[model samples]
Target chain A: MKKLSILILILSSAFAYAQTPEEKGLEIAIEADKRDQGFADSSSKMTMTLKNANGDESIRKMRSKTLEVQGDGDKGLTIFDQPADVKGTAFLSFTHVLDADDQWLYLPALKRVKRISSKNKSGPFMGSEFAFEDLSSREVEKFSYLYLKDEAVDGEDAFVIEVRPNYKYSGYTRSVVWISKEKYQPLKIDYYDRKKSLLKTMTVSGYQQYLGQYWRPDVMVMANHQTKKETRLDFADYKFKMGLSERDFNKSSLKRAR
Target chain B: MISKMIKTAVSCALLFGFSQVKAGEWSGYVAAEYRGFTQSKLDAEQFDKSSLSLSFEPEFYHSWNGGDDSFTFVPFARWDEHDPQRSHVDIRELVWLHVAQDWELRVGIDKVFWGVTESQHLVDIINQTDLVENLDGEQKLGQAMLSLSLIKDWGVLDLYVLPGFRERTLPGKDGRFRSIPEVDDHTVYESGAKDKHMDYALRWGQTFDDWDVGISHFYGTSREPRIIPTVTPAGLRLVPYYDIINQTGLDVQATFDEWLWKVEVIHRSGQGETFNAFTGGFEYTFVGVMDTAADFGVIAEYLYDDRGSDPAVAFDNDIFVGGRLAMNDAASSELLFGIISDVNNRTRFYNIEASRRFGDSWVLSLEGRFISAGSMGGPFSSIRKDDVIQLELARHF
Candidate 1:
């Protein structure tokens, strides 16, 4: 009976008269979003390796926590653990679907909290190829989608879709993503700049299932086509359902994020 | 009295008890600095146009009870080659924190920072200034307090009972940055309890959309002192006199895309004259300049003091214009350059700070300050030829 229901779902979604390619794309995105919701909270270790055009590489390590809000977007905190100069510094971000995200930084030396502008969508993250735009949680409502076609990624069947950011201040014009058909996860993405030129490409790999329900990528690498720089992120030590609440993501918590 | 006794006992315990708790974290740095001045010595008691110093700071942190309770210890020490007053030891932060569902309790010594302006921080009154370290007055001596914070959906309200006031450290006559008629060893206070006088403060902070606001009130001994001339056997010396007072402060900051607007205002009564002062500015950033990852910011701020000319206070009737540059590279290099000009006089102060990291454990910093010759009153009147440049390198552990 479960198999039969799954078959019916696929058939109806494929042949629904009101479902144009755009609607199909949105449906696919919504379905993907639904599959990843309700984890409550999670913590992980993140390491980023940045390589410049001359092939010089620098590494940064941080511990991260994420809390999922019911109706709004998620809240995230990252504490720097390496590069001893910034050891105790922390960054806090509250993301929204349409409006600009709110961000704050805690400077350890001064023991001060500074609110920073979040309009730097195309700026580098820690001087890496991954821009701040690439690090925010992708909400389904933040973009308009169009179903392009179906293809295979890493020998797995995938769907190709074109997405344009609905927000006006976005540094990106459009992006094409290849999402796994079976897992409803993104396998790769190609970002376009405001001039509609190819800007960067990100490849995701090392898929691992957490709590036997959620799919997470363990490795993500971004290559900038214009600057000839690259950044690779390695994620590890994933813990889910840590009983995190808004209390743990508040401004007071930012001071002791470590 | 009982609470004070308990605090002393607990501090002794924490000072020695931390070694046994081996599962904690440690971080700090040791630095060596070299300062060179542009002008020669003007007085017989003054040192040469160069100085050297070494500083060390170490921190230890431990948390237990499922991360609900924590303790922190930080000690700072400095050794200056020429000035005895600059060589000292201090407890920068030695505090214990307890986190509850909707509130927090903190005790022991720590530092609290307030205000949001590039030119000056008028509302930051919790910690006394560590003046011997730098002329920018950003370094602070640790303050002992009993603090309680109530965190709610609307905002965070903090109450503090402060004790054990630390006197501001001053450079002596032999020091390079000393004002004429150098500070004497004696200090006078209006409060009968002197340095032991208790103080109180409260602050409520909240955020609305793009705006962040804070309103705070402080009642106690003033952190800033009034300079009084005294005749002594050695010579004419300037004595620091602390007065009982009340101060109210309001600070607001708004972040709008590439533009950040900030303002800090304070009203104080009790010291020489009751007056109001304000400083506000905006920073407009050009992100990704010239198709590079570097960002350049232009900043301008106006400072106003109702009293007009007070020597103890800088930034009175002044205009501050500055620029900040961040080279978004792996090395994390940055630069800040500014000039504060007296609107009514020819007095101008130029400042520059630049820093960059090397590898994972080291950083190099350069700072330069130049006070041009002109008509500025108070302590500024004596330091006309004190232009200096300093370079420092530190290694972290």
Candidate 2:
């Protein structure tokens, strides 16, 4: 009887160990979120490709400086390329925690910057397939997450998690995410629209270690399922912890930005 | 649809004379186009133009179901060859309306246009003509209006008050073709009475099974200037005032089976002069074109002015014939061909254009125009028109 009891305890310990794979995947995802949560950095260039319902594709390239202060959200200067009339114009956005974000766009011809409000977020951006809401910062608290499963990504184990947004204005309802177990970084996410249908798929690639403890993705791609339009963000020449503050985000300082 | 709370709120507001809503629908479109002009006259001239135009067309299409209300604006502009093309922008419609079961109230910028003809002097007042049809035309979006109607099985009776508009400035003429100037805040005439900007009109129309017909009578202020300053026998400029201005007209139109016809006659009271015009046109579906549906249209018009107005302003009083040919299919966005011949001036204008659509978001257009003759002289002094070519890419949401 003593031997039998000892054997049972040993089996229980083995079963608990076997569940570590999934448990570890969850921890990695949580750690990755923490890493991104504290990041404050700026990037220079990004290219986005969009896929349409017909399988044809369109590309939107933006040349801009993006300053992202995590938890506090992202603010940036964006310039559009291609259309001659809209060239040289600039855009700015500042995301706040407890309130709606504020945005502004400078039209060169008008020679003035116009403040954009909540009413206009659903509208198109310069007649592009993208909406103003799509460009705003994604607050971490805006969503609630649930661990779904574990799977291999690129031959490495990953954890699958589903997140549902809590915002009312969001065009999407839920997103399914795949996070790398070992690296504690998100690999891909599938966005579902209001009808709970797959609307867009976002992929994170080129994961690079920054500051030894930070795992940052060098590229993020978001593709719209209906419009066949995509946007790609390529992080380059990132400078972290430059002592950026709220003073730098003022409208008066935007014009002096290089 | 008005909700139960809104109905209660609206009722209380009406009872207390409260007006204005914090939320309303505002929508508009803008066009910036570039074009080169080819002259058909002697000393053929070429002009190139890049224009940016914007319009704010807000419509209050919805109101208290039983309340009389009105609001709409359609403003537009076109810069041509470094000068402002005929500016057609205006506070097109602003009506104060009261609605009762049997009677509806409407006041301000209201004109009833009823005609099937492409160019209707009689019914073209309500809406501006499609831009593609008139290359250089004076269709200013002007006039003050008042209309009252009783809705019926056929149509409604509408009354209006019309206003003479400040003449829109066009291009190609000295003092005419000037860069789009900032809009004037005010203006006065030489009569010491300022611009006699207001008049009145009454009209009625009915519609039946794809057919609509209407007759309208207008009594309004004339746009014709009463005084002209000219150089006289002594090499001195003198001002002459003329009262030969008639300020009344009649208009009629009908539409059926995609075909339209219209007629207008204006008789001056002082000068005993008359201006009459008639127009007919139609659009038809052309099948068996590359297995996709195609369309084509044609228009012809005639004019007779007993006054024989000067060649300088064809819109005032003159005889001319013009027609348009339009074709569209899966192969192209819109293919248009057109010709206009001035009978009195002995000049002609023609153009061909092709436009294409990209994805469902953008439009790319290519167009060219040719003028066989512009100036009367046939040599170096004559107008040698340069081909006007334009390429416009636009995206709308």
Candidate 3:
């Protein structure tokens, strides 16, 4: 009887460890999402530095504003301020979890607002290494997750997750992300192209707490392996919950974005 | 006269003390251009085979009253060595704007654009065409206006009270674009009030997830004048007659992924008859072509007018095909090639434009235009013998 009980115990333990990787990954993603709720709105200024393989560099200044939405993806606006040729240019986006994002660009020279095709979301953002899709708010439902394993990054425990986009037009086939265990924030991400080759790697650092509840990263660096190009974004002046609404993000507001 | 206008503009800028205003911004550009006609001077009619020109445009902006009120002024001037008519000065924009929670008001000389078609801008008529500047009809002269805009969740409504009319600038006798002799500057008006007559316009524009639409109506003097040949003491000249007219226009665009579909239509009752015209087109883009960061786009547009061959402009039945190439490089390099072909006849017009930045503040541009033999006797007859290439270098500050 004791021997039979020991066999049964071993069988039950094996069964408990047999959960699918997909299920485990999804649970971790949901947990991260739950921890990042209730950030109503935020505005920040950023400086972007772009460098080529030859080490040539150019700098750009911009201001960004974002509004967090319930049951939907976020709304964002980025207005360019430096570089005489691109000054007064603005980009506005309305993102969705399961649908293509809507975007518009206001050109100062033409004094007109042009709608950007949704398929262009995968294109480069303002000649930088960061694609438009990468700049957008990452909604949990946009991708299907598969938990890879638990790892330590820079002496901090993190959950390594692999996610495949559910949308058809995404430029990436899959992305592997490392989320810090303590903050549930992405510490690093590796992007794979449609051919399943590693394309780029992004590292997030300089994290600071805002309003005592929300954490924001101050520096983000994206490097493209194929082109040997790099883009570094430094964010400053973060203000949250300043009474922004939907009306502030509409098309007409593009003209007043300055 | 040009120097006087410049002095007045400078005095106004100083009187307002705009430079002293905190947070005010000033920007401008200066450009030099050289044009060489592919055709001989004799074949090009009265136009010079080679010419040089310089131009400058400066703008200033200031905000006060806690950012609720703002002021802007832009003065533009150009000088050409070969064509006197091409050298002129004008105020591009001088406006005082006041913003509220959901509405805004603007009063001054401003420029407005309304259209969706790349081949032709049928609905864009608020500003007079600066014909001497470019054959593409993209350059515009500012007009004095009182505009009020109301913004809402559904869309935006804009009402305009255009108080004065600016006559279109015509090419000089030595200019390359003139189809006929020089147009007389003393413009004739059908209305007794002439240039003083007030014009009004209203437009409502809205955008959805994948669609952008606009509807507009204008009841006022027609910007395109009917040219009447008349003998004057100086010589035989073309007299421009501006007529009163009413026009309704619609523009729509649908964007789906890499494809964009656009349509623009207009119905007008004026001059001698009522007519309808439309332009519809589509643009498809291939991004990251061949695994590079370059983008290539193909565009096709069809233009039609009810007047057919009898129309003054000769766009009765036409098709336009164009290709745009963007390198997506750091210098913002781009090239555009297009051909406008008349389906009813063998007339065809081809143009190419390419530009790239040299450094942080300088840009270089190249342009060329050609016309086929069938273009004779049409609107392009004036330039039947003229094929030209141009180069320009500009510096921004």
Candidate 4:
């Protein structure tokens, strides 16, 4: 009778710990999503620095804006701002289901807009070795998550959650995310491959609040373990609630925009 | 011409296997170019003519390993209008190729050119060259081969055998129209030595962190030297006695940090004579942008005809130095500029070309080639220059 009582007490404590982690992780993920969902009042521009294993580096300036509708799925458009050859080129993302997404690019020389098929979503973009899927939306439903453990991140109490991709076509199979308990923001993420091997790691830093209720990360760094390549994306000058439309995302509109 | 066309069509149809029609698994494109030449003051229309260049390459692939492993075949056809404007269809490469996890094999007629030099000196056994008074052309093709390759973690080794075909010979101006002068008459045309007729070749390659290394060797007859003839030393002969058959060769290439280097050495011995030749060069991309890249290449090559051993063949030594610039855009256009310096006479040959890939169905190209032959040899050998321009369009299905 005494042993049974001890076992029941242990089980209850374990369940309590599990609930705390899931709740903490959901808070961080949801808070970040809410801030990233809105369109900017004006067009925003940012510079990104990508470093490779050989110590080579590339810098890309990008212009991005959000579309009008909140749930229409075609929510964003990004254009390349540097490199004379690929300048004025635009990429559109649509059909943003939790499972699959569609994207396209308009090339100036060919004077044609090409629909990028799903089969090649995992391949490198513009021969830079970064997969197209890496640049897409990371919807919450795209992964199945479970709280792993409690840890200290950036000198703050944090909850670590393991997130596994639910779709077969995803380049990474699993990722471990560390969320700070105080701010409910991601500190670091370790991405895993199909072989269950660690492939890449991403770390977020310098979180800044915008528009009183919204929080934005100043920078995010993604590094490929095997290739020793790294990409640093810097976000700045963020605005909220701008009006954009589907017609603005069309191929013909790419030429007129600055 | 008709027979060559029929053979080429049959070979292409066989290599492609006609499966794309049923499986719906193929995509392709076609290209062509045309050229017209103005006769030099030294040689009239006899050496100059309007020429057309057309090429068709149909590619086919069969998937295996859940589509990871595949068999890819690219068979090409080229038609050129030679002097006197006889149409020639060169079946450049037609082979059945297979690529798996660890093996690659190719059988049938094909061209396997290995080297980093703009002008191949040692490993150019599969093409033929045409010679004019002021132009130097050596192109090799239409040879049958069986090759096997094994892939390793860091490198690959290829072994191959070639049968029935070789290089076309060009004689020195002094030794025109001689029959097997530097080679044996019997071996040149006897046709029964299948044992020695088969050419053996081996190439091994390894890629390093920032460089690639390759070594290859071939034992066979000289593709160019088969006929022989006796000629007097002169400054104005057109067709020289082509001898020096039964040639063996070795080639090497190394690519390092955006730079490519190559070397080739050839030795020929047959029917009482021997000669040695060597060539080397390098290529590198100097300018690379988003949609375009420019490659600058240069070569210093030498060919020694060592007729000093057999006075009967009677020849003079010749050397050449050249450079070429090739610029290409990712989408659909390319431009090439080339210059060759004839060391024997201090003359020069220059060529420029521009080509565009049109839609998915056709391609168009324009080219201009010029050659300046100075007063190098003959009594009437005044400064002669030939300028040629061309435009062509081609389609494929």
Candidate 5:
């Protein structure tokens, strides 16, 4: 009887060591989030090139500023600087963990600040391949994760995980992300539509270190699988600890944005 | 004339300082439009059955002193082949702005917009309505003012000291949207200072969570003039009587996922009798409909007034329903269709506006408006036969 009891204990301990896919996925997400903390604020300039299936291209230039929040989602603002038609247009966003993000748009032609309807998050951003939600700060709490498996992407070992958005009005049903094992940064993401069909694939490359601690990608490309369209964002002029505050991210500041 | 001289001097100064400026921007659009009326010419003096128009708006921005101080100049002009009233020129914006850490100061003519409702802008009263530009009253004539905006942790506060008043432009006799009796350009003022009266306005706005709220107050000459009939040498003309009034307004919007709720209310005093009006609406959007990169939005609103049918405004008691479609394509195609109906009468107004970009620099737009048979004495009674369709092509530079 004593030998049988000891055998049962040994088997239970082995079973407890094995984690479910969901738990493992969540653990990986938590680890990534932990690694990305302490970036108080940052500012950068980006140029986006959009290409159609016909290989036609258009470019847009914009500047972005972000403010990191403790125990909450971050805040961000983007100001369009080029494309004369959209010049002086600004967008402000306040992301939340468990709630819909707040967004406002300043239209230079009208000289008015308009609050963007939250349901429009799934819409395209400035006619680009990216959605408004995609441009926002991605909080770990905004999704539920499921670990898929370990995969190698471009000769680099990566962990594949699937994330389902927890918010309503999401245009995508699920997204599979490839996180590099070295930096725990997102290497690539595949978005799926409501029908669970592949919609778009986004790849991040050209990683650069800032402040000797933070890693940021200098180039991101998103290709629409169904439409055969693509958008490439080239980032530069990264400045961290810019001292951005909530006052700089308000509607009034949108008018003063240059 | 003095304003023109000042503008010239400012232009010269800007040109002289252009070499020292780090950056500047210039943008404008030239548009040509054709309007076709559903009805033929009513009289020989009236405009032709169809008309063509051209408009141009050029804007220039120059930032100096390391972007802390800037100057913006936007001049607009339009020419109509048939209606002289529609052929006009105005300075849309000419402002010198100074920005500080927590406050901003702007002086000169500028346009200010405030409100959240789609059907009507009840709380937007800073600028005078440019009536001849559009029948929907969405266009505004710039006003000269000294504005100071303060930013704080609680909210944003804006104070305006308006000095010059812009008269409402009225369509000429040959125009399509004129009243039965044309409005006289000569205006009467209830205030002793007439157009020189220094108007004042204040607004406080803030956003918290999903809610955006604003409260504003304006005290000055009313933008909406009372139409009084006067016997002229040939016929009776409607003269505008600008009354001194005080108005308080409130606007609020709440965003919840895919839904937006908006409300605008206003109360005005000193127009013989005080009156209150409100407009409330909601917009719901469905994104990526049918697996395509298209969005569809449904909008509904209710407009009410304390005086009901006897109210001065056109939308005293009405209901509006609209739908917006966005293609989310490279061309940025959009279409909006709406209908406004009288709650107590058999009056309905339908509108459809569609626009799409041809390329990086060109855009084309089409608009149609129809009015159904309505009871007498309503706002649309005079223009009920003026259903029209318009097409416009614009080139941006």
Candidate 6:
């Protein structure tokens, strides 16, 4: 009888060692988040192209600077440089973990800094297929993950995970992401609507290593299945560790963001 | 090598007193506008209801000292088909800015706007109004000043020393939108130095959580001129009288969820009598309504002024309600409509403005204004026939 009890204990210990899919998913997310850290600050220029169902296209040019805030989310400033009507327009944001972000908009025509509401998550950004929430910094705590399975995406081994937004304001019910197994970077994401129907698909490509450690995507294209519209973001040269500080992200400095 | 010599040359030029500065970039827009009035001109001396105008605003910018110091210049001009007074030119901005670790210094002619309410700007007294540009009073001529701003964790305190003032632009007798009795270009000032009288202002602003507050005081010549009707040598004309005044203002804005609340209050002494005026409003926005990719915002504000006895200033007590629609599309189209109605009388004003980007470098804008010309017989009596629909197409570079 004593030998039988020892065998049962051994079996129970083995079962405990095997993690559930949720736990495994969270472990992968933590690893991915860890790899993206230590980039003190970054600056980049990007162009956004929008295409309608009829294949009509429009382009936007902008420059962005981001500063990493220790123990919290990042601070970002974006200045619009093209589409002449919006030239010199600037936007400033301070993202906080588990708290609402602070946003400010600077309009060249008004020549003033105005505090804006950050709760408009479902709204499109710059008339693009990307929603406002999609452009915000993605913290590990913002979503809950569930490991679906392992799949090969475009002949590359990747892990498929389903993630549901933890925030209440997100327009997406859930999203399915394909994370490259080797690089721990996202290769594609499928967003679902409130009715649990697929709404948009985003594919990322052209990964470039920056700072000898950081992996950044050169292009990300988001397509809306419902409207048959698409928006493509083409990133230009990205400079990391630009020595940016808190003073550069303040509202008063928005007028000089360029 | 060549690069090292060029770097040394740049450093030497910087060491000297800017003997050679880098060439600045130029950018601006040229707009052509057409205005069609709904009614005929009110007076025999007025011009035709159909009007055409062309406007240009060019900007030049240069930066140095690792971007800590910079200079900006913008010049604006307009050419009217009719009314010579409407054809004008002014310096919009020509300023040099220096930024230090905690403080910033700005000198030269600059355009500064200070107000929170949407119905009217009760505390925005930094620049003179370019009245001839439009009756909506959204344009201003630059004022020369030296400003110092101390930025601290607690708040931002700004001090200004204004040395020169630009006279308010008035409409000519032939102008379509004009108050009866043509205004005399000559002006009388209570100050001994006239337009050169020095002005001083200071403002302290801070943000707490979701609220932003600003308190300011200005002791200078009032931007609004008192139009005193008198029989001049030419005829019965309105003479503009400038007065030195002391004004204090407070503005606050609170942002919560999808709602924005704003209020601006001011107390002025030296115009005619000491009085207090206030304007407050709120805006609530709905995003992604009706399964469409558009955002709609509803706004309402109350305007109050105890100086109703003054005939020159209207909208003493009014309620303004408005709506804004932003179509989230590739064209980036937007529309704004508002109505301001006097509480004491039947005076009401309706305004509509819409704009959309055409391509990479072009935009189209439309504006329309309608007035009821109610019991308020001040400026409304003259502008009753000035209801106009304006369209502008601009090409930017």
DockQ of each: 0.73, 0.01, 0.53, 0.03, 0.55, 0.69
Lowest summed lDDT over 10 consecutive residues: which window, candidate 2 chain B?
Answer: B174-183
- C-alpha TM-score for every candidate: 0.95, 0.46, 0.93, 0.49, 0.92, 0.94
Runs with alpha carbons beyond 4 Å of true place in candidate 3: A1-19, B1-23, B42-45, B233-235, B373-375
Candidate 6: C-alpha lDDT:
0.86
Tens-digit lDDT string for candidate 5 (B93-177): 8778888889999887789999998988999999998888888888888788889999988889999999867778888888887
Worst 10 residues of 3 chain A by lDDT: A109-118
Docking quality band of candidate 5, CAPRI definitions: medium
**Per-model root-mean-square deviation over C-alphas:** 3.2, 18.6, 4.1, 17.0, 4.2, 5.7
**lDDT of model 1 at residue B87?**
91
- Candidate 6: misplaced stretches above 4 Å? A1-18, B1-20, B233-235
lDDT of 3 at A225: 97
lDDT by residue (B1-397, candidate 6, tens digit) is 2233234334433543344357778889999999998888889998866889999999888888888887777778899988898898777777778888788988776778787777788888888898888877879887777899898998888899998667888888888767887778878898999977999999888889899899999999999888888886777878889999999999999998789999999999998889899999998888787878888999999998898867666778889999989998778899999999988778889999999988788889999999987864664878888899999999998
Instruction: List, residue by residue over B1-397, the lDDT tens digit for candidate 1.
Output: 2245346536744754555566888999999999998998766798888999999999989988888888888889999999999998888888888899999988888899998898989999999999999999999988888999999987999999998677898998888777776777799999999989999999999999899999999999998888898887977878999999899999999998889999999999998789999999999988888877888999999999888766666767999999999997888899999999988788888999999999878999999999884764544666777789999999988
Query: How good is the docking of model 6, as DockQ?
Result: 0.69
Q: Which ten-residue region of model 2 chain A has the weakest summed lDDT?
A: A249-258
Best-performing candidate as measured by DockQ: 1
What is the C-alpha lDDT profile of model 4 across B243-286, one tens digit per residue? 32555565555544334455666666663456666666554444
User: Model 3 clash pairs?
Assistant: B179-B382
TM match of model 4 to true structure: 0.49
TM-score of 3: 0.93
Q: What C-alpha lDDT values do all the predictions have?
A: 0.88, 0.48, 0.85, 0.54, 0.86, 0.86
Give the Cα error of residue B248 in candidate 1, in Å: 0.8
Per-residue lDDT value at A105 in model 4:
66
On lDDT, the leading prediction is 1
Residues A79-109 of candidate 2 have per-residue lDDT tens digits of 7653333343677776654355556566532
Worst 10 residues of 4 chain A by lDDT: A108-117
Chain A of candidate 3 compared with the true chain A, TM-score:
0.92
Candidate 4 segments exceeding 4 Å error? A1-258, B1-32, B40-86, B127-140, B153-155, B166-196, B208-211, B230-250, B254-258, B288-333, B357-363, B375-386, B394-397
Query: Candidate 3 on B203-233: residue-level lDDT in tens?
Result: 9999876899999999999998988888879
**Descending-DockQ candidate ranking:** 1, 6, 5, 3, 4, 2
Give the docking tier of candidate 1: medium
